[model samples]
Target: MHAPMPLISTMVGGLVLAFILGMLAHRVKISPLVGYLAAGIIVGPFTPGYVADLSLAPQLAELGVIMLMFGVGLHFSINDLLAVKHIAIPGAILQIAAATLLGFCLGQMLGWSLITGILFGLCLSTASTVVLLRAMEERQLITTKKGKIAIGWLVVEDLVMVLALVLFPVITEMLSKEGVSPTEILYSLIITLTKVIAFIAFMLIIGKRVIPWLLIRAARTDSDELFTLAVLAISIGIAFGAVELFDVSFALGAFFAGVILNGTEFSHRATNNTLPLRDAFAVLFFVSVGMLFNPAVILESPFALIGTLFIILLGKSIIAYGLVRFFKHSKETALTVSISLAQIGEFAFILAGLGLALGIADSKLHNLVLAGAILSISINPFLFTIADKFALSRLRKNTTLTDTTSKETAKPIDKQQPMMPFSDHIVIVGYGIIGQKLLSELNDANEEVVIVDHGKEKVRLLKMEGHHVILGDGISEEVLTLSGIAKAKWLFITLDNPYETAQIMQMTKSLASHVKIVTYGSHLDEIEYLYDQGAYEVIEVKKDIAITMASKVIPSL
Candidate 1:
């Protein structure tokens, strides 16, 4: 294979593997990440198929990292990160410290070097944003106070992880060289900080001023490919400069580029186009990381592996839960935030790479930690189930360790919550005929009703009709918050999906335990599930339709 061709070949092979395995994973009810990891292992050097030459792949994968971080930055406004810093910064630090300490202890017990131990801990210290976001989306938790706080914490963690990546290399380069002194370390630190500060200042002061103008010019041209390429160029260019000029990691540059572009009006389009590219490369990156796993070594070090897993999954969960509690989040909110952030993610790989470059991590150690990371990501969803059960059990016994101090911390809305008598009441989850009929009935009754729909046209139509409507994902807590679920006396889930209704019901129960919940579903099983989730009444639409038809026929007869 030719130089760049081998890289292309590996990328193609990895993406195909990811797509196929990802579909299979979905069919089997597992995370697509597990499939991606499995694909990497199958096509890795240890397996029989086309071995992806990772040396070339990792370099390309760096593009993926840049784009991924860029996307993260674009969606994440600094205001949000700053607002939640209280929980995010402390939660991240404590979680990292706990995981690192546990890894060091496990490393000593396994007779590994202190460096290897630290590497293991570093890998475990980070959580996968991709996985966490997907999980939060699935659970309809993404729009909650808990979700916002959790993601904000991840943001801070990524920033800290970036800084650590920069520092590790400089320190290692100096220490590994001959005649290194304390003064050299100080100088290296100063030089690194200067580079970082200068790079950030340039991005904020310079990039921000220039990128908007550049994007507007690109948009005027109306060339999607050019615009896309422009986005990529800016991202890669900044990242490269950071690495070459400031001695910062390319990831930091990519992040800064994102932060810069985040201020621009063209951010949404930039992200939309870059997402496909990001997904393709990110899959390859995950595959490449999986290729480093030496299963034999991991199996041999069973005690260490098991111990590390506990620390990453259990210990980190505890730390996050405690921090959330200390921050005065509710029991449910604490559990929710903790469960979402229990797995290691992209920064773990970055740290592992840094450790390897610093000679702090050997092949065996890297492989061991990488393998464990994949395992954690794979099992994260299942672990959430366990977490929910544990929380429920604790809640049942009224022994939840929750943060009850922050009265300002918003709680998720609950159905069945008490409400003032005769308050305007409307519960709209969709805008279809069923919802329209319900709305009409409420209007005739002279009650206040709120419409929740993500459909743009429906929201517009509802607004034109003088109906109170909020446009957003109905399943999202933010959407519910906007809908004033906490104040509503009645909730009508007219959405067709019973699972979504169940989530809304559960989340509503946390915020308002006395509001009435009425839901409509097509299936009896779904209706039953909705009922179990605290629905005061679940009407099977199909059954009701049949009953109405029979009543009309009997009357005619």
Candidate 2:
């Protein structure tokens, strides 16, 4: 136990440090994980007296991970999962197994225990939700088919991580008991499996049926705080119940609770309301992760640090690229999806926690994992940009049937069909430069293009030019349906708000998977997120166009 007064002061100080560091990283266009890791180094044994109460930090961090997982679960609807189920589950399992084997081999070479090696591999399998999700939003690929698979893949990993969490403690407990045998282990496994099955069935089937009714009833009271509290209560309550009654992880329950509410009409409202809470607690989670690093281990074994970083970056990328391509996705799709999964995530910290508690990991190994996670996460966005460049080069070189581009596959529009139903058309969500360029190119090529803009004047102008236009915000479901988005062949989101674009794209993907989507965004980092959201193509307008012009201009001079 920690001294209360000192603990509180430590926590407050740690938070302040984390905030400042995060702000600096963001301002300098780096991942916040870099800031968090730097904070950890500064507050570690090497630095001055600002070190957080390590004992208390873990507890608070647990709460943060729990809430974070709960929020993840809430975002995952059955429909959303089902839409990308084929790739998500199998792809994740295969990736996990492959990573474990590789990690085991690497550990053997490093002279570590097999169990420790396996734990390290498991840690590598978990992709950072914060990093990947942020990247997805930036690229506006959140509605593409590739995006759906990426998110679904993450969802599967989240489930696996939670199960691992539950199993670790139980296995440790059994190992300590008298007459521990294969038979006893098998019995325990069966019992645990049964409980998990029951818990999932209750949450998805029973809870799904019950939760929306409760939310609706609460909403009728017209109290915003009440509604918000009820949302938290349900999330926290079900999560806690799973831990207490079913012997499961709180993250799993919270996630399933969100899945239940996903079917409701008020899900958007729920997401809006809960986002503030998610952001606050999420900060604590990152801060705690930052506070765990030991500079001594890193200094003692720079080789190990380098080796771990290599495995995190190169190992994951190779596996992701292979798996995504094996699923018959395009090279560009495969590359973006692969890059998104290249880093270890928040779940690694959770797994490390389990390992520490069970004494499966030594301080050196724990610090190594923490350091690797931080470094890998920090460079992830930059890595995505590199991946995209490689993918684009590959796309340009490939002339096979697998090559999917506007010029190669899409049919030209017929002059006779001027009033073609918006069905089987690409819906352009904005009329900005990228949107206009895409519209013009697609139009010239004879592909069906229907434009939607909230600017009434823009709509009128498009109409005057004999282009089909819908006047409304693309973020709204009513506007989407009215613009014939449900029937359209692709969704082209050219909006400014990365978050809104992601949400819209996700919803659009849910409605139609065959309808491939291609969108544009302001940042290269967001390309992965756009891929995860279900985009078939994510155009990084700033990087690609500017770089193209720069090359031409430089060469001419």
Candidate 3:
């Protein structure tokens, strides 16, 4: 139990140092990302200072990644992903292939085995999602067309790495004296794919409904504490669950969790609520990445380190840029995408660790990856600033896919459709299962209904059913006005995301204070906050469930 103190110490100590340096980095007009990395180095084993617990820092760093990816998933959209699919999907595949070939050649020259070479190449291929996201978010480029392309491209890299992690062992077994068959490798790949598919399906179908429902229940309790806990629970639980049960990467799991939520009304709220936690731990993640660096690699193998750096920083960037351009995007878009991919991160360390454990990689190779990650991540922040100064607004304005730029502002829908003026109607903010249920009940009661949803599929279905539907973000004032909130008799907020729920609540009351406001809370602690936010009625979901369940179970009493 006492051993855990070191873990706590590492977290607290790492944050303190990171904060100080991060402030300094800001004062110097550089990205705080540089300062975070520097802080990690100062506390890392490579430097001559108070070293943190290396083992413990990584586990905490994982939490940071889980939160960060969840935040990304919050603002992400399926449409954004599809827009870049042409460039991102094939671009990432070929980029990884090219990088691996480069690494393989370098390993051959270094006299390492084919397996080691492949692993080496594999590490070089994928850019650090953490690094890329932090850089993109710093400049507020994540929701832009180019940002989506980079994000989609990174997703491909993550999926490939997951596949590689599954296959590494089989290949290692073959290379061993007790050789394995090709059949074994094939079978392993199949099993890995099966797990990956199962996880994705589960998240999209089951988790989508379950996670949001749980959060809605949590929100109804009106407990700010519980609502926040519920958000962390959903994000961290799904992320860790993916790794432990499905044997996938934690970031991939969390990223998908956020993406799944993105399809729901709760996305913006989830992103806003999780931001502080994500930013704090994300800093820790950078620090942890820095902790792995061994400065000795520079002196011992300057040429080798330079070669590795060249492959990661220059080679990958050019390949990514060329691929984006091949897909017919403007040079500005191509270069923006390329510069983001220039750095490698968390996934590289994971691969290196596995290779070292399998005896396919030596300590020297591990050091190279670590050193390369530190250098790229530290310098990549400046590279992004340069890209911004060079490209700035031109990149966004000049994309070949013009719709990709404009449509990102809102879900591109046909404007020819007439707005149905819903009067004396029940205006609902979300169109999830609860909202749908309430919509049905209100219809059964012969009440006029106006439903607002961010989901195109739901809007389509609602329109087909002859219901008044507004297909825009609930957070938007224009969307709210379209929903006729001021004229509506009753406003029902049924989004599972408490943050979004609270936001909409404030928006609704501000728009129509005289209109009756009824909303649900996911936690016991949320009731007061909801009241403060102008809710006329705040129903705590869990308490209601317990009361209803108790009434049925102990009626004799």
Best-fitting candidate, measured by TM-score?
1
User: In lDDT terms, how accurate is model 1?
Assistant: 0.75
Q: Which RMSD values do the candidates have, in order?
A: 11.6, 13.6, 11.5
State in Å the error of residue 169, model 2. Answer: 1.8
Global lDDT of each candidate: 0.75, 0.75, 0.77
Where model 3 places Cα greater than 4 Å from the true spot, the runs are: 1-4, 68-76, 134-147, 165-177, 243-252, 357-359, 381-557
Give the alpha carbon lDDT tens digit for every residue of 406-505 in model 3: 3343323222222444467788877778898999899899998888775557877876676777765565555666667778788888866566667777
Report clashes for each candidate as comma-separated counts: 13, 25, 16
> What TM-score does candidate 3 get on C-alpha atoms?
0.65
Q: Which ten residues in a row have the lowest lDDT in candidate 3?
A: 396-405
For candidate 1, give the lDDT of residue 318.
88
lDDT of 2 at 461: 79
Instruction: Quote the lDDT for 337 in model 3.
Output: 91
> After aligning candidate 3 to the native by TM-score, how far in Å is the CA of 211 from where it should be?
1.5
